[model samples]
Target: RRKAKRGQPPKPTPPPPVPPIEADEQVFAARLRGALYFFSSAKNRNAFLAHPARYANAPPPTSFLPPTAALLGPEAQALPLARTLSRKLGLVVLSLDEAVKWVLQGASPLAEILRPIVESGTPVSPLHQVQALQLRVSSPDTLRRGWLLLGAPVDGKIAEIMRVCSVLPSRIFGICAQHADASIAGLEAALKEKRLSHRLAKIDSSRNPLAQQHEVERVLLPLLRLRQQAVAATAEGEAHTAEGLEVTDDDFVAKLNPKFGFYCPVTWLNERRLHHCGDGEAAVAKRCAAEYKGVYVCCASDKQLSAMLLRPEEVLAGPPLPSPLPTKETQQAAAYGVSPSLWAELSGHCPVTLARGPKLGDYASRALALKEGKKEFCVEYESKRYVMASAECMEEFLATPWKFSRLTLPSKLLPASDPLDVGELPTRGYSEQTLGDSLKAALTDLLTLERPKYPTLSCTETALKFVALHLKANNPNVRAPHLKHKYSSKLHDYTERCGLLDAIMRTARSNGEVAAHSTASAATDATEERDQGRPGPEGSEPDQTTATAAHSESAACKKASEAPMPDLATLFKAWDEAVAAGLDIH
Candidate 1:
């Protein structure tokens, strides 16, 4: 090789650093087809369309200023607005309806296939739609100027069309919401008669109405999707490729499904109305076009209407609720019911054990009320009107009800065979290998012998207290935590071993239930709110007869209240008298 001359050549400096190859001036055209090859001028465009393969290796055209001009709206707006958007925006508005009609008029081979489907409810397939759009937007000139795409990317096909195409609309210049749901009645009547197409065609307002360029400006300004900030940042910077974009169809579909879809014309009440759909009025107009016989249901709400009408396609996945079933501690004011928070609450543990009534030797698991005129007062410790009967002898019970109110009772118990089950007798349990037999013997000896002793006092007050005191005095070791009564250590050992606590409570609740039933009618008139521990109905005292009977009952109650503790033998004699008098006893 000869050495380079110093001044003449200077080694050519690597050919001025090879400039990057620019893409051909255009890659797409409007209403023209050439094997995806772009041309710079009309001469080159025609040359390429004539024989696309001759330029098979045509360098990809550099990205044109993206089609910043977008024309999207519902089908309703598309019919009237497409012509206007054409003149106003100076965009070659490719209305899908016009395109389909144009194709069918020429009876292109693809249009021949699309005609029947297009005439019927079904849209031309996504592929066919893309191809048709390709023919329109493929021209080299159209790609650079960026013509407006009007209403082909309808519901259920937007993503497929967008991803399959080599480009996307960079700017959304306008959105129009046709107030169709608001005027549903007219559409419904037209649809019901199947004369909607005829009526729409006949409508003078739709055909040659005064063009309100003002209307376009008004609607476009308020409904422009991108804010000023968003507009300042153009998406043109994104690299353009002749290759189709790859995206998961599912993600696109899911994001778009809720935002845009075909709504039935039928109303929520199922009235005859075609539901308007799509984001733009223009898009909605396309669907409503007579060429497409598709049916749609009305959207469920204004949100659905507005979102499909004007909202941009954005994903909004809401958070889920914690549970299907919610608990209620307090009733809402809307319920028009008493607040659950204000209502009386009950503890699960038995109220019988927490009551102080037992300490006074007056043990009953229920509260009996004494009626005086209109109001009733509880005889239990304090003013607690629950299932507790008072021990007239115990003052300690009034101070603390929770400590001794709860009562637990044995279940599945059988009564004793002998009539003298409650008599003071030491019935022994026989040990047995079988669990059932052993438990049975133990319960029987306990329940029949020392538990639920025969009533001994002449008065109800004396008898009830005496039984409570007797058991506690006899049984000491075991702590009946619910029972406020103190037991003697030595005297109560046998009582504790018998496990007769349940039997005693069982008998007490039984007698209380019986007493409740006997006077339930009178108590019904007292107050239903008594169950809520509220005061009885305010009213005049019962008539003279009621007052007389109450007086007599009061006298008996007073006498019982004043009675002293009676001997066990005297108490048993009183029980014998009650038995002879045909009163039930167990």
Candidate 2:
């Protein structure tokens, strides 16, 4: 135990080995992808933001989804795609509650949590946050290829398709009256008779029997190539595991047919295409070659193309997707050239745009000032002043910008020696006092009074000076010129020195203080003084203390020789007679 030898002394056995932690890259990556994909779709993004924790443990089901499907559940179907796509986009896929918690802990940008994973290094992939998604499904093969070949699960394809559906118009059917060799009058007559020419408008407006078919083809070409690539990849992935095992499942070629539904990039719907082969192998490819098994594109009498998709087994095993019987409503939509799927997509995503605005007011003001060479007459409203060319036009106008337009507010006038004449009646209304005329009236009153001293006008010092000037001008005989000259400076000095007004004000303040102290002192002296003046509680005569004080005061007064006392009885009789005559004591 005491082996303390050199360096090799006590190389104690390392503490029990700790198990290595598992890397969560794949799981985290998948979650991130899901978050980005959800945010990319307007519908899903809105739903999440509205109820952050709604998707924490679970979310609500969207349109056409079964009740059994819990929309908010973390394990819900949308998550699979969300995880994968989030990885592609480089976004973080944590629940809204988690995101909020991080933000509360001083996390910045808020989007940082979702951004890194969504933008993970993919060039073509969309960012974590997107304004909208436009879904354009051209073929079934595209969907099949995206799912089977790119290792994308059905959920992932569904998520992408949902996002793409968000930006399309709401109504699938568009209508236009058909005019084949008909005059405008004839068309008007037809309309009056409840008849109109119509045809179904495809969701992809670029594609039809004619016009822009090449553009449609151009966009569709890539999907076709991808389909081929997907097929090859699936076959390779399958063969590596198949070894020499013979596959007996050959229902593929028998199930071949073209069918369409809501398709987005990298996703398609095909019954016999493939399913997970299990045992870690790609699903076997099956052809959709069955006769009369294609999806029915129903065109109503009005030209509406409404789809009634047949069951997967029906399309794959024996029959084609049934053509939907067109009702009056469907017919009307088709007549207008609107596709149901397109309409659905459009309604799913609503887009809005607005025009740009003009420059800021300050910038405009500076520009206006620069345009005029000299400083123009101006007045400030709400701390913002702008110059105008003329004062006569606006000098007396009210500048209420909130109620009136800036153009309506007039410019102010600068003082001049000669009496300034306004050019015309102002477009805006104003108060005479606003024209700096209040001081003139006050001064006029001060000078007309017969009193020797000036009356103090309760107003700003600026107004006082103007008032003083009027007094000096009107009362020339009095030596009040010096007083007028000193008025402004005296007012200023008085406000600064005593920090108060004149004698009247000081007297009023002193009286208020004296009254308050007297009230308090009277309250305190009440018990002692009440006994000396009034009778006791039981109606006894006045106390000895009061009698003694009265005697002392009477003696002192006698020694000084004061007025004679009057008889109480005589005084009472006179008072009674006065009362009888209706004389008031007050």
lDDT of each: 0.39, 0.31
Q: What is candidate 1's lDDT per residue for 65-84, written digit by digit as tens?
A: 42323444445655466577
Q: Which stretches of candidate 1 lie over 4 Å from their true place?
A: 1-4, 7-40, 43-84, 101-112, 115-211, 221-586
- TM-scores for every predicted model: 0.24, 0.14
Error of 1 at 564 (Å): 61
Please state the error at residue 4 of candidate 2 in Å: 99
- 157-249, model 2: which lDDT tens digit per residue? 323333243311111121112333222233334322421112012223223323323332333344344444433433433211111111122
- Model 2, position 202, has a per-residue lDDT of 20
TM-score of 2: 0.14
